[model samples]
Target chain A: MLTAILSGDTPRSRILTVLLLAVLVCLAAAPFLFPGVRALETAATICIFIVLVASYDLLLGYTGIVSFAHTMFFGLGAYGVALASTHLGRSWGALLVGTASGAVAAAVLALLIGLFSLRVRAIFFAMITLAVASAVAVLVSQLFEITGGEDGLTYQIPRALTPAFRFGELFGVNLNGRIINYYLVFAASLVLFLLLLRIVNSPFGRVLQAIRENDFRAEAIGYRVVWYRTAATCLSAAVAALAGSLYAIWLRYVGPDTTLSFEIMLDILLMVVIGGMGTMYGAVLGAVIFVLAQNYLQSLMGVAAGAAEGLPVLPLLLDPNRWLMWLGILFILSVYFFPTGIVGRLRSGR
Target chain B: MSPGGANSPRPRPQGGVRLAARPDAGAAGHDPPTEAALTTTLLATDGLTVRFGGHVAVDAVTCAFRAGELTAIVGPNGAGKTTYFNLISGQIAASAGRVSLMGEDITRLSVAERCRRGLGRAFQLTNLFPDLTVLENVRLVIQARERKGFGLLSTAASHSGITTAAEAVLDRVRLADRAGSKVSELSHGNQRKLEVAMLIALDPRVYMFDEPTAGMSVDEAPVVLDLIAELKHDSDRTILLVEHKMDVIRTLADRIIVLHNGALAADGPPAEVMASDVVQEAYMGKALEDV
Candidate 1:
């Protein structure tokens, strides 16, 4: 399997195949090895994050078109699900409507922004995404009424097709409700990941890489350069929307601040970059690193919050604290030593 | 097999500049010029022209390229030889004039589309993707031909026939041993050879080779020249060569064109063009023997 995957096969295709197989094994062994149902549901949520980053990787890492507004699709997805469950609140139809709405909304946003900014190039593209995302955050926060402002909206976790599990009998562990959510997200993320892999291995995928390597040459070869870039952006936003919708459903809480924040965009971008751009596995690696760091920082901040007020070392992260500083340090180190990200360094060169 | 087959039309001089006036091989068409085979004009330009600010680089060139023959455009420095080639291949748009390939107007098409329609080009300045490996470079074009590109995220070069063709072309170019080497590692001569190998591996219906032998030792010229000659008679494609080497052209070009001051100064078989006064004046302001 290792030879089959890494032996000149496309980076993403092989990765997806390996990951899918692993996910299957993990799902099958979930009850036997793990004690809690909540953990399984949380794992599913993590898997969704993995797909979201992978899709973003295609645009940012592969094509080198970084848009900080990428997670806006996720927010769109969340809102779509929120409106559907509350007002449109149809049962079976919410899944399709939510996913499609999220994707379409994200794509529309990408298309509109891309029309103006795709012409800009380099750090300029990043600036546009940042500007747009920041603007969106402000609007969301200021709206107050429909978005519930800072209070956020609460709803029950959308029911999954799979039956909910009981941790009570197996290991005396209580999942509360995260187990079903875990499996639901895991299944969805795996399918999307595989589909992305297929697209990357096809003829269309090569153009993206070719564009990445040299856009001028690719254009000279008669490709519609801007159109392809826009298509990629649209696809990326759509996939991110899926994650956002799940965020709404999984947490049973929809908050404008969480969905529209620059901090969230920074986290997603950091995950992909620290994990590596252009390599599929980089997304998973990035998400893993990001989640772990968040958990660790939260704990560290908890300790410092109890200490001194003015000079708490963990500062914003620990005391009313700043997690951003530690995260920035992590990114700096990743850039310093593993400049190509984990997956990229291993994929290129003879 | 002389590449300019029996059907190639005796080129009709638009401005009455007879083939005999140009210096190098300016004699009349070897065998009364006949129409090139097939109804299709593989590459055609109608009054193609380019102007750079105040200076006119290429002026109103009207010509057509056909399959199964080797044609070269030759001239002295600053004569806009490469510029003319760029205008035809869509690297730069003609200030005025339409370029068409196989009956389709391609003046407005992007470079990649022209490539997809079987138009392949070799650059004068060594435009190989420097960071990619030798074999990987060839595989890129081959995979493009297979229509297996653009969609896949995989870095693997060959999953089928594309790999074999890439390897075979490398071997044909005698760079088979360097397949695993980075492009930067190859000797300059090998790099030039690799460029031709890259152009041919695509099996393009028309191969535009610009100065295939630019900076080679006298000895290295034959390897590339002979390769072009072989490619010419392959019966599968036509060849458009832009060369600076006279000996290489004298030995290989079926027909030669001289561009001087953005205009066609001569066009005829090699020996005839070599003996023309117009060609002489275009090059050094005197007949070939005086220089």
Candidate 2:
């Protein structure tokens, strides 16, 4: 199973495989072990973000393109599903419609950006995507009537996935809407993750890696660089949309802050870089580590803050109020030491 | 397996000043100068020109590469040999004039489009997918030939036909033993061989080799030159070799073209062009003996 997911037979790979399996088993059994809504919600968000970051890796790691517009697609998916559920109908059919519309819209947008902006050099292309993403985020916020302005939209999900539908008891635990929703998210995320694995292992995936390594050489060998880049962008955007739709459904809300924030984009970049660029396992590792830190770090900072105030001179060194500073310092240290990200360093066994 | 396989008409000299005259190689058991085969043009540039602001890089260079022959373009530094090759290969758009491949106009095609139409090019500088294995590099060339770039459902590793073909190409270049090694790990000469191997896998109709043996050590230069010679005879492909080594030119080139200050200085059979006074003054500097 380890060999199926990862390349090579090194000891590092074996260790990572075992670690990944442990994480998977733990996630699967989380609700039962913890038996609470908060734990279940945390586990579910981790799952959604796993899909999101993995899709982002398709561009950043595999295709060697740095796109800052990932969250735009994510927000598009959430908005699509949320709008469909409210206006069309709060049914499974509406969910399907929402997912399809969101993916298609994101694909078209990606294609257009790839066509027009990709002519620039790499760093410049990144700037163009950043500009376009920022502009769109503002557009989403300004459309107050339809997009609910800055507050965002809230709507019903399919009844089957809601608290109104109790699907009996399982293993002495009541299988209510909450438990069903968690399982649904878990199953969907797993399927998408595996599908992404299949894609990255295919010939098309090899071409993407080749492009990443040297697009000029790829073109010299007769591979149309633009078409391949555009295809990768579209595919990444489509998958991100799927993740966004799932997040909206899981939360029962879609807002500018929740769905389309630049902060979320920054978080994704940190996740991918911290996990490892190019390596699929890095996406998973990065998402799990970063999301967990995000959820608990503030509280940990609060505790440290109280303790630091009592200290003689350690107050400035580890300020409890500046969580971002601490995170940034850790990030710099990781980058300085690992250089290739945590997964890359671990796989290299250095 | 000469080019055209007894079907092509010989190339006719377009209206241009003849720099040197010499005996054609027809009497030496080569193909007789049927007006048809002698005039069969595989690639031709008509008044091709390029300029960077006010500095013209390639100035009105009109020449024809015959279907089965090897032509050497030689000149001193800053002579526009590489730029001319770039224009013909569509690396950069020509400022003016047209480039044609086998009678079809290709002046406006992109590099990849030109490649799809059987134009193979190797850069003066070694360019390769350095992160890919040597076999993987060749495999990508073959994969491009097979139009498998969009084969999302099929695994690139499991494609037996492509792998076998790629291995065969590696064997031809004698890099089969290092097939699994990364391109970056290979020596410079080996990288040159792998670049040639990639072009061979492309199976293009015309090959444009730009300074193929440029940076090789003395011991490795002859091996690459021999491989290139073998390629010319083995495939019967039209070859445009950009070389500065006069000995290499004398050994392999059927015809020689000398470029001076972005203009054609001399064009004819090797021995006759070697004897031209204009070539001596503009390119060879001291004399033919000094080089």
In terms of TM-score, the best-performing candidate is 2
Off by over 4 Å in 1: A1-45, A108-153, A159-168, A301-323, A344-350, B1-40, B150-159, B180-188, B216-222, B284-291
Q: Write the per-residue lDDT of candidate 2 for residues B144-203, one digit (tens) a residue.
A: 988988887555777889999999989887899999999999999999888888888998
Candidate 1 lDDT by residue in tens digits, B1-291 = 111124422233433234422112333422222465436457766666788886778766656666676777876677788898788777887888888887688888767778888788888988776655788778777876776655444544436577788899998888899998988888899899888888887788888889988887778777778888888777667788888666667777777776665655566666677666556544524334532
Cα lDDT tens digits for candidate 2, A272-314: 9998888877878888888877776767878776788978867
Candidate 1, position A4, lDDT: 36
iRMS, all models: 3.7, 2.0
TM-score, chain B, model 2, is 0.86
| Tens digit of per-residue lDDT, candidate 1, span A1-350 | 64334433444445545654564576545644555545454455557778888888888776778788876777888877776666655365765676677778888998988777786775898888888887776776677777666666665434553335344444544543455556566677767876666555545665676677767656644455677787778778888888887777666677866676667777778888778877777887778678756656656666767675676453445543567677777789988877888666555531
Candidate 1 TM-score versus the reference: 0.81
Clashes of 1: 59
